[model samples]
Structure formats: structure tokens, C-alpha cells
Target: MIYCGLILFIAASIVHLAFCALKRNKAADATKVFLMPLLALTSALALAPRLPESRTAFVCTLCALGFGCIGDVLLLSVSEKRFMAGALSFFAGHIFWIVQYVFSPNGTSAYAWGGRMFFFIALICFICYGIVLASTYVLLGKPKGVMGGGVIAYGGILCALNFTAINAVVSGINGKAALFYLAGSILFFISDGVLSYTVFKKDIPYSRFIIMLTYITAQALLAAGCVLPYG
Candidate 1:
């Protein structure tokens, strides 16, 4: 039943992405916006049972799915304020991930790589921030509805989430949990990479099809990450 739901989760996301790509029509976006949450909920249902009944894992799973749902809502929103709210929501989600790791049975393992993890996360934020700031000159010139600063902040937060998940996995905090999270992080990175390439580098021909494919893959993997594996 759980595996079936996973397959469905992926299928639904694919459909949502296809809907987004095939038509920029308002109806398409509306359909996708609604479907995203449903997909997330289903994914959560698929994975949550795998976790140990411990409060830590349970709470972590809730936060993962909750933040994922909030993120979906934020992306669907047309308003920047709403989007900012969403970024914050996901930021909180990342915090949950941090807590999940801190409370894992492998607490000692977390310490082994804690310093290295923080350093890398900080490095990523600094670099991504610098790049975004430099590009603001161009973004500001355009009618890009979102403030350049807000855009940078959103990217920074997402990067933070990625790092949080990466750290959770790499730190040996939780083996199965880490595996799920790392997979999600990889997909998210790929999605962002495609988006960055499409947005910043115009030389490459952009396809909504590719964007949807990666986006769906990212979201699906993220939902899978929330499964809260016990062993």
C-alpha cells in the first residue's frame, strides 16, 4: 500500500507538471496548485508509517509534510507576500529537520561532522547570496514582480533547507532518514540547477517540459524524504 502510494505520488506530480507546461493558461495553474497539496498529502501517507513510533521521528515527519504542503501553497500563490510567507514556512520546516537530527538516536554521530556541516552550509549561503546580489542589477531593471532582495532571500532559504537535509544525511544522524533526505536534496538541486540555467543563462533553449519534469521529480523526492524511515 505504501509503495503504491509512492508511485501515485510521482504520477500525480508528473501530471501536475505536465499541466503547468502544456498551458500557461490560468486554468492550468489553478489545477496544478490544487493538485500539489493532494500529491503531498498522499506522499506523506505513503512514507509516515515507516518511521519508529518515537516522538522525534513522528514530529519530524509531520514537519516535513507540513512544510512541503506550505511550500506548495506558497508557490501556487500569485502574491510575493504569500510567497514570502511560504519561504518562511519552509524555513521552519528546515529547522524541524535540524531538530530531528539533533534528537536522533545517533546523537553522537551528529557531533562527529557537525562543524564541517555548518561550515559547508555557511559557504553555500555566502556564495549563492553573492551571485544573487550581483544579478540584482539586472533583476531590478526588469518587471520581475518580486523584489530582488526577496528573491535572494527565497533562494537562500531553499538552499538552507537543502543543506539541512544534506547535513541530516551526511552527519550519520539517521541512516534511513538520511537516505530519503539525500535523494530529495539531489532532485531539488537538479530542479534548481535547471531553473537557474533557464533564468540566468539564455543561451540554452528553455522548455517548460523539462522544467516540469525536474520540478515534479524534485517535489516527489521531497515528499518521499518525509517518510521517516526507522531502520
Candidate 2:
């Protein structure tokens, strides 16, 4: 079932990417919605791998991915309200991830190397970085108040997600799996940066295409990360 779900997700992802590449905006928008449910299903299958199940992880991941789907759909529109809505959706998703990591052994479980402090410190640093980046975006990017707030909030949430993912690795939760999540996180941050710059700052040539590519890759990695066997 896990392999089947993974295969189905991969196939759907390919077709979704094709729509984006072909610039079939409507088709792309329609197809993108299916990705998260497929991803959530893929992640669900991973929960049964071990004896005592980690139901929390499964549930939170599904919640986050579902919100991601909503965000994706909302983001297809260019309106400020829709953009804010999308940002809120992603913010909620990140919150779910933070909660999932915080209480789990992957986060709360201490390592012999004493890496708990690293995650504590990393979380703070990530938030600070978000503030700095948001400040820069506001100063140079020139987004409006609502959009700017959404950007700033979303930036913080994204960083929070990344920090939790890193902590998952440091705490020996799922080495390779965590790496996949971390990679997806980094790409998500980069993709949003490009999106803000392109939307508010000067638009670079083919910037839209670049954003699409990064966004698609980020989502795929995140989906796969959810189900990667712990190493």
C-alpha cells in the first residue's frame, strides 16, 4: 500500500508539473489540489511500519498537507485577500508540524549528545531570521500592509517548520527522512522569496516558471519525506 501510494503520488506530481510547464494555468490549478491528498495517503502508510504506532505524526502530517492543498489553490489567484488566505493556510500547517515535532520523541526525546539545546536555540534563530527577512522584504519589496503581514507571518512559520525538521534529524528521529523534509523546507523558503520578489519587486524574466519549479519540487520532497523509513 505504501509503495502504491508513493507511485500514485509520483504519477500525479508529474502530470501536475506538466500543466505548470505548459502554462495551462487552469488545468494546473485543478490538478494541484489532488497532490496533497495523495501525499497524505502516502504518509499515512508509513505510520504502520513500526510496532507502537506514531498516530500523532500521521494525523498532524495529514492536517498540514491538507492545509497545503488549500494554500496552493488560494495562491493561484492574484488578489491580496487570497494571498493572505493562502499564507494563513500555510501558517496553520506549520503550526501543526511544530506541534507534531514538539511532543514526539523525535523532538522531546533527549539524545546522549545533548542536542535539545540546539533545537531550542535554532528555533529562536529561525524566528529572528524571519523577522530580518520580512523587514528587508517590506523595505525593498514594498508589499502592502495585508500582504506584508502575511509574508512576515508566513516567513516565521516556514522557519519554525524547518527548525523542527532539523531537530528531527539531530535527535535521531529519521535521519534520511528528516533530510528530505529539511531540503523541502529550504526550497519552500526560496520559492516564497522568489514569489514575493516577483510579485512586489521587479519581475525577472521567467521568474514565474522558476517559482513553479521550486514550489513543485518542495511539495514533492515534503510528501516523500513524510513516509521515508527511519534510518
lDDT of 2 at 69: 86
Off by over 4 Å in 1: 24-27, 34-54, 106-109, 113-146, 173-180, 186-211, 226-228
- What does the lDDT read for residue 192 in candidate 1? 51
- Give all candidates' CA lDDT scores: 0.57, 0.73
Candidate 1: C-alpha lDDT: 0.57
Tens digit of per-residue lDDT, candidate 1, span 133-193:
4565354454254545555665565565666666666566556756666666566555654
lDDT per residue (tens digit) for residues 1-231 in model 2: 987997898888888777767777788788878888887887777775652557667777788888888998899898878877887898888787677666545543445435577857676877778676767666555565776666666777787778767777766666677788778888988888888776676777666567877876786676556555431
How far residue 66's Cα lies from its native spot in candidate 1, in Å, is: 3.0
Query: How many backbone collisions does model 2 have?
Result: 0
